[model samples]
Target chain A: MQLSPSLSALVEALRCLPGIGPKSAQRIAFHLLERDRSGGTQLGQSLLNAMDKIGHCESCRTFSETPVCDICSNIKRQDTGLLCVVESPSDVLAIEQTGQYQGLYFVLMGHLSPLDGIGPNEIGMDVLERTLANGNINEVILATNPTVEGEATAHFIGEMCHQHNVTASRIAHGMPVGGELELVDGMTLMHAFSGRKAI
Target chain B: MQLSPSLSALVEALRCLPGIGPKSAQRIAFHLLERDRSGGTQLGQSLLNAMDKIGHCESCRTFSETPVCDICSNIKRQDTGLLCVVESPSDVLAIEQTGQYQGLYFVLMGHLSPLDGIGPNEIGMDVLERTLANGNINEVILATNPTVEGEATAHFIGEMCHQHNVTASRIAHGMPVGGELELVDGMTLMHAFSGRKAI
Candidate 1:
């Protein structure tokens, strides 16, 4: 089914969003045009404003409107020597929401995907190396996802930290809190058992 | 945790979309800022362009860039005297996609919601009455949804058609095609049985 030219353009453009398929794009386009024109205008202006003003932070490579991100520039975070390595800005936001980590972060923006030709350089590993070489960071925390690509990237970064004489550590792999043992995956249960700490 | 000013603005604006909550809005914002900057810009431009160009058709109240909608202006439709009354522009699009309804439509833009102060005048029912009084229409088809407000609006429109000396009919409500009998709701099954016709 063909929509009007402007409606079709809106639908196509909306499909750029992550997880939004053609049907969702069409629904959103029709919704905006039918009932919420003012809201649609606001969303458009907001997108343009964000795209025009936001850029990567020089120190951590996370999104920021200024040269350095808020977390990177803040001196009050108590653990400046501890750096958590993550895959994307969303990961940083997720960690921040936990309110448990007081350390800085290095955002890789993506994982190593050999088939896609995205390697160390493509995800700014060189910049991470330069930051590690500065000798201020005493401990590096590998907090990438548990996926295959995330694990490989974390292992590579751990090796880099070893070479730089910085203490390297990975966030513990185990069953989640309040999760039943039967529901936990086999690999996670095995990892939890092997990494059990002394009481 | 607070995002950058523009990023927060983008997230807030994105929440205006239907079915999108705070978490989804944030995820979409981060996705656009991280990987699809160009696409984000295109989406922004498209929204602005669509909003600037699209307007309600003067005759049937459906979306159109011109004064009269394409359906209303089309000279080749089989029955110009058959008018379909629908709730919104999306409803018109849905009917058009079926390839069965060749008649023009009157879009109400909303149903009768007395609690929300949306009555006949609010949904352009007076204009519909004026159109029916023109004596060009022979039959009016009530195609509103099965919801309470939609039923009320259809009944009100039916009364108006009766006063104008025009024949009124309603779309059938029953079990969907290919639907399993056990899975169908009791009310729908009852409707199907009562409305059954001779082959």
Candidate 2:
């Protein structure tokens, strides 16, 4: 179907969002044009504002409007010697939601995907290594996801930390706190059994 | 967790889109900030451009860059005497996609909802009446959906057409093409049976 030029452009632009297909893009375009023009305008302005203002934190590489993010700057979060290394800013938020971690964070923004040409430098591993070598951090927590790439990235980071003589630990791999044993997958079961501790 | 001001604003702005909840909004915001900043900027510019350029067609109320839409101004679609009244601009697109209708369209953008205080004038019903009474139209197709409100709006328009001495007809309702009888809803089956034709 031949949409108006502006509408077609809007649909094409909307496809840039993750998981939004052509049909969804069309629906969103019509929705913006038909019911909420002002809201669409506001969204556009907000997108511009975020794009212009937000950048990676200098200390941790997480998204921030400032060079150093809120967590990195706050004196109250005093665990500067303990750094949790994560794959992305979203992972930082997830960990923050737990309220258990008092340390600072290092956001890689991605894992080491050799097939996709994403290596150590691609995910800010060089920056992480520099931070570790500079030496305020006493321990590093490998909180990358449990996927194969995540595992490889964690192992690489662990090796780097070892070379720097810093303690490095991986987050536990086991059944989730609320997960039922029957529904747990075999790999998780194996990990849970192998990593079990005596109460 | 407190996100940066611009990031928070972006997340909130993303919520304005239909079906985007807070979680999805946050994910999209992070995706734009972390992975696709250039794409986000392009999307922002596109949104602004679409909002600035697209407006309702003065004649048909469908979205258009011009005052009158392409369909309304096209010389080849000469069946100006046959008007198809629809509930929304999306409905206009659906009908146009069928390629069966050569007539002009009258978009209501909404059906008559007394409870919502949306009456005849609210959805441009007065304009429809004016068009019908001007003696240019001979037939009005009531293609408002099959919902109760759609039915009510169609009935009201049908009455207005009768008052203006123009023929009014409702689109057919029945079992959908290729629909299985057992899986069809009772209401649709009833409609199919009652509206059955001779083989």
Candidate 3:
């Protein structure tokens, strides 16, 4: 027999989540219908509110309900004149968690992916170039991931910074502090050796 | 730094889904915001619709958008005078997928668990008892999971069936089909021996 109409719709809709398969969708649907209707309703309302209100920061291209994000608007952070470039808002969150950096950010949202037809314009490179040309920033820290696409994206942005006469620096690559050398991948070891400095 | 209000609320609300933690919730929130706002909004509408409409089947206690679920409202299935009892509506879906069971069902929605304060009433045993008292069902099949609590619940319901002079049968416990005998658990092997049937 067919599942109840709304139940089936909820199960089908839940597959919009990244990792959920049919079974997981059904399980989640049953869970909400059976145990937590209120939570489900709350999530529904939250999703609607977020999708409707959350837009990109006009300055950094990161998620923000306001036109300019908190970090972008902070005079203290803006005065630092150091803009860290990265892909995705989650990276911004990670860097903020460290509480080490005291500057603003420029979120690429994605990197160059030529084969899939993604290019500089697709990832808001034009905006980054405009920010660089404004010349308020002292340095551009490219903290994009070390993957091939991330590297290519960083290289492209570095050229833009050079054109605008802004200093550009790629974040250092080395062995992670807490990782064991034996378990580390060969590529990481190679980078560690190449990037070594005197203590 | 604080996530934007709606973004943070979406992240918090996403944790209501089973198996989602803070990190996964954030990832999902970002993914939807960046890549699939339409899908996210669709899920929101679906969740609202399902949560608002879906309720338990009046007859079997399975999820239903209407007063009675499709299976329970079927005259052909109900006239068969058989009622299969299961712990959750998902089990009914599983059984329906097999295309084997031909009768109506009675869903407990949960099993007896004294330690957690769950009892017959919590599992809707009173509903089952009423169905039996109505004197329409000839047999009651106990198809709860094979865990210890499930076994105890089945036993309790079996006693209830006996009191009402209704035949009750637990789903067989033995090695699964296509399972390797050597790899089967010891308890399953023992049950296989005890439940062996002659061709």
Candidate 4:
């Protein structure tokens, strides 16, 4: 069906969102037009504000509105000198939700993918090297994803840690909490066995 | 986790979309921020334009940028004098896809539901009354949904057609084209039996 020009444009633009296709876009447009014009207007304003105002934190490369993010700016976290390195801002949020760790973070924004030409410099290793050389952080926790790219990125950062005489550790790769042993993958089971400690 | 003020506001506004909860809203916000900032900006403009410009078609009560929708403005459809009455604008699109009907449409935007305080007038029956009273429309096809409310609405409009001496018919209900008889519900099986036509 031929939609009104504005409606068609709205539907097409909505497709930029992850997983929304043409039929879903049409439904969303109609729903907004019919029942939630005020909500649509509010969403539009929010989108514009966020896209225009939000930028990466200078210290961590995570999304931020200011020069440094809240975690990086906290003096108490700075004193701990425990830096958790993650691949994205969402991972920072995930780790923060645990509330068990009290440390600052350095978000790479992405992991190394050599074929994609994402070298150490591409993932902000230069900034990381600068941070390490300053000697503030005692330990760097590599909490990037467990994929091959994440591992390669972590190994590269580990070498940087050794050069600066700072300790480097990787986040564990055992079965998830509340996951059954039977359901665990072979790679994870092997990691769990190999990394076992006296408990 | 405490998000930046703008990010928090964007997540909240994204909840206005249908079926999107907090997690989905956050995912969409982060996805836009990380991967498709341009799409987000374009979507923002589209939302603002659609909300500000799109209005209900005066002739059919369907969404339209102009006073009348494209279908209603077509001279040939006006000359046909066959008006299909439906519950919403999407229904107009559904029927139009068949390419069998060369007629006009009157969208009620909703069906009769007295429990929700919806009455004939609430569903634009007054406008429908005038349309039928005017001799322009020859046939009124009731194509409201097959719910209890839809049946009541169609019955109500059918009475109005009688008052105006206009022939009124209902869209048939039976087994859907691809539906199996074994899987069809009792109500629909009854409809199929009752609505069976002799070839």
Best by DockQ, which number?
Answer: 4
Candidate 1 per-residue lDDT over residues B1-199, each given as its tens digit? 5798899999999998999999999999988888899999999999999988989888888888778777887876525689999998778878888999878799999999999999789899878988898888899999999888998999999999999999999999998999999999999999999999999
Model 4 clash pairs are none
Model 3 error, position A130 (Å): 2.3
Give the TM-score of each candidate. 0.93, 0.95, 0.96, 0.98
lDDT of 4 at A115: 94
If the candidates were sorted by their DockQ against the true structure, best first, what order would they fall in? 4, 3, 2, 1
Best by TM-score: 4
Residue B60 Cα positional deviation in candidate 1, in Å, after optimal superposition: 0.5
Query: What's the distance in Å from true for residue A74, model 2?
Result: 2.9
Winner of 1 and 4 under DockQ? 4
Error of 4 at A178 (Å): 1.8
- Fnat for each model: 0.90, 0.95, 0.93, 0.93
**lDDT digits (tens) for residues A135-184 of candidate 1:** 98999999999999999999999999999999999999998999999999
User: Candidate 3 has what TM-score?
Assistant: 0.96
Model 3: lDDT of residue B155: 95
**Alpha-carbon deviation at A11 in model 1, angstroms:** 1.7
Candidate 3: residue B182 Cα off by (Å): 2.3
In model 2, pairs of residues that clash are none
Q: Report the lDDT of model 1 for residue A173.
A: 95
Candidate 4 per-residue lDDT, tens place, B76-181, comes to 9999999999999889989889989999999998999989998888788888888887799999999999999899899999998999999999999999999999
Instruction: Chain A only: list TM-scores of all candidates.
Output: 0.94, 0.95, 0.98, 0.97
TM-score (chain A) of candidate 2? 0.95
